[model samples]
Target: MEAYLAWVAIDLVIPNPMNPRRDHSIESEQMQEILRSKGWAEAITCYRKGQYYIILSGHRRWHAAKKMNEKEVPVYIVQAPENNAEELDRLGSIQGGQVDWTPYEWAKYTYDIWKNSGKASYSQLANKLGISQSLVGSRIRVYKFYPRIEIEDKLSNGMYSLSMLDYILKWIKRVEKHHFELYQSMGEELIRKQMLKKYENRCFNSKIAIDNIFVTSACSKDILEFLTDINKKLQDCQFELELLKVDNEVDVTQNKLNVKMIIDEIRLIECRTKNEAGNLKEELNKLLKEIELKENQLFDMVEN
Candidate 1:
């Protein structure tokens, strides 16, 4: 495509209406600092449209410039592509080299293109994008199954990764194909949502860990039920914690009775033999350690 470099007025440069990125938050602190100290390391990629240039890439840089109140920014203007497919290909190619798009974003836009292009075949669309047909199919499936905005939001928070989603999708398909009855019982959409929620809450780092845990059983009913049970238990635990916070003096009478019992036991131990005292001290130390560990766990649960 024909291209040229120019210094464009910031006001005249507009964000692409079709840009897959929805979160237009300012650049990171580190990136902003870089802009302050060393301005314009790379030019904004754009194309002219009527009175304004639509950004194809470097959107974050444009945002940083606007936040800094810079009047003008460097831009690399390119010739607009002839068709929608070419434009999308150009957009993907340019953005792929910069800040990564989430899988949901990729899938959404890919689906959009596919739909607008008269519902093109996966192989035909893959040929245009120069990716495998299987990948195109999977992405379309992901787009079809997941709520785009919610998944995008969670993914932006860094708790989830595309690789995890990839494996989760595979697991879902395997369940649908191999364990058809269970899939119908739970529904594919619910399965996807629950798996994603459980994976995030548990803070699992490896997709394989989740896959192996869920798919190991020939009968996945038990495993799926166990996941649902864990979710309920976690909700109940959180609810209990909130209830405890409502009553500061909850179980005070019982606590006092337990303390008195402990004190009486200690007094009896004080009057016992030296060897007995040493053994009691050892047991108390171990018990104290165990209590400390349990207390820490409770604190974590409350905080969560």
Candidate 2:
């Protein structure tokens, strides 16, 4: 591959139509910041076509330069092949550095590579990416999540870690279609929050989690059902608290009645032994004061 650095006009280099990837990539602004701070670490890839140049990769960086009002930007010009389709497909494999492509981006363009090149085998893809077949297979499964655009923004924005993404994709595969669709509609962060709640044990068990997803995830049939479930839980908790309050009131009432009975018996004793009755009445008054304090506490609980 003949390659050389050339400062090309910003307007001359255009995004290739055949490049299968979403251009609403979240990395453009970050790249702009990086270019402003670090001043362009690597040259973008392009090939010449007559007078104009076409970009195979680095669309984000290219757009970032345009935003900065740059007339021309440096690019590594890879010699154009006669058959542009096959060559662009080949070059797509080597586009950008580590963290450039989102999982969805990979799925889209990798599908392009497969289709353009007449559908390569799994081992062929593994060999091309220099990874094991299983990793390639896992990435292919991630393609299924592409239909979920709400997640695309997050996934493209670097919202999830590799291992967490692995677990999420795994969960998507095993979960019921409707539930998974519901989860997809709920936004990525909410699902991530629920996943982390389950991942508190740090096991990342998708199979077991999927089995209990409805209960754990608060899945509901409709708005009425959701509200009904929440209201029912609240009512049950309130009922338990009310039972405790009732028990406390009953104990307090019984103590007050017993104190009354004691006072009556003491009055009768006073008729026979006045001095002993006086000491016993003083002790009974202290006991009655303690019970009154307990009753006040119960009142406070009710008021609150």
Candidate 3:
């Protein structure tokens, strides 16, 4: 059937509720820019309701035209097979196959059509959409495991692709299935990065291995800090021990010199300088006590 080109009021073309696409911000902006430079050249597809129109495609263009305050939009109005759930499903599949639909978006739409169109009957429908039955099944598997949206624009948009969504789904399932308890709170993006890195390095074969590697990387920080602290303390103690050893050698040498001087003074003045020798002995005792105190402190540190 040939679609006739015509202009319709932008408000009359309603967005489909069955459409799984949540964010059209990027597309809308691009459309608005295109409208400014070239106007709405590519027509949106739609079908007539009694007083309004229902969109099968170009919801983003419709929205962008409205934002531009355009009174009407160019459309390819499919007049037949009008407004029913089944018809919506058919056109929706048509819409889903467009280049703009991300993997999750495609899967979500296909999964819906697959459910409502009846499973046994959807094989032909799948072929009509240029998609294989098993491919549709894989897409449905990807769709059913869709992750919770944190609603950040880029993250949320990127998550709709097959790889990211599949990783997140598998990550969560693997965590639960394999009992990787330590990684339950890790962010999806971080774990995804770790998986990609390990996969590239060929170091990890499974999600469990990925989780173990991530935990090891995380704990390596604490391990490094503990080692650093122990090394510093040991170095400080060794320096003190060396300092005390040097002090002990100086004390012994000084005492020997003092005793020799006292013997020379006794030989010349008949033991007149005995008090000087006693004073030198007292100084040596003080130095020895200081060394003993320092050694005790080092011992205490080691025991603790």
Q: Name the top TM-score candidate.
A: 1
Q: Best by lDDT, which number?
A: 1
Stretches of candidate 1 above 4 Å error? 116-119, 123-132, 153-191, 201-227, 231-304
Ranking by lDDT: 1, 2, 3
User: Sorted by TM-score, highest first, which candidate order results?
Assistant: 1, 3, 2
lDDT of 3 at 133: 70
Each candidate's TM vs. the true structure? 0.57, 0.49, 0.49
- How far residue 190's Cα lies from its native spot in candidate 1, in Å, is 4.2
Model 1 over residues 1-304: C-alpha lDDT tens digits? 6688999799999987777777666355666788989878889989898879989888878887887788999999999767776677677888876777776778777887787688899999999778899778878877776787657767667766655677667767777876787788888777777777777676333544255433444356554664465354333433444565556466766777887997798777663688887888899999799879979997998999
For model 2, the stretches where C-alpha displacement exceeds 4 angstroms are 18-21, 24-30, 33-42, 81-85, 88-90, 96-99, 144-150, 154-205, 208-304
Instruction: Please provide, for model 3 over 1-304, each residue's C-alpha lDDT reduced to its tens digit, 9 standing for 90 to 100.
Output: 6779888888887876667676655567877998899966789888776877777788788888888888888888875463344775656666755646655566767777766666545567568567777667667666665342422233344523454444445644554444344344444454444444433343323343244323233233332232234222323333455676689899989988986886686466422488977886786689679769978997998999
Clashing pairs in 2: none
Residue pairs in candidate 3 whose N, alpha carbon or C atoms collide under 3 angstroms: none
- Model 2's alpha-carbon lDDT is 0.63
Write down the worst ten-residue block by lDDT for model 2: 222-231
Error of 2 at 131 (Å): 2.1
lDDT of each: 0.74, 0.63, 0.60
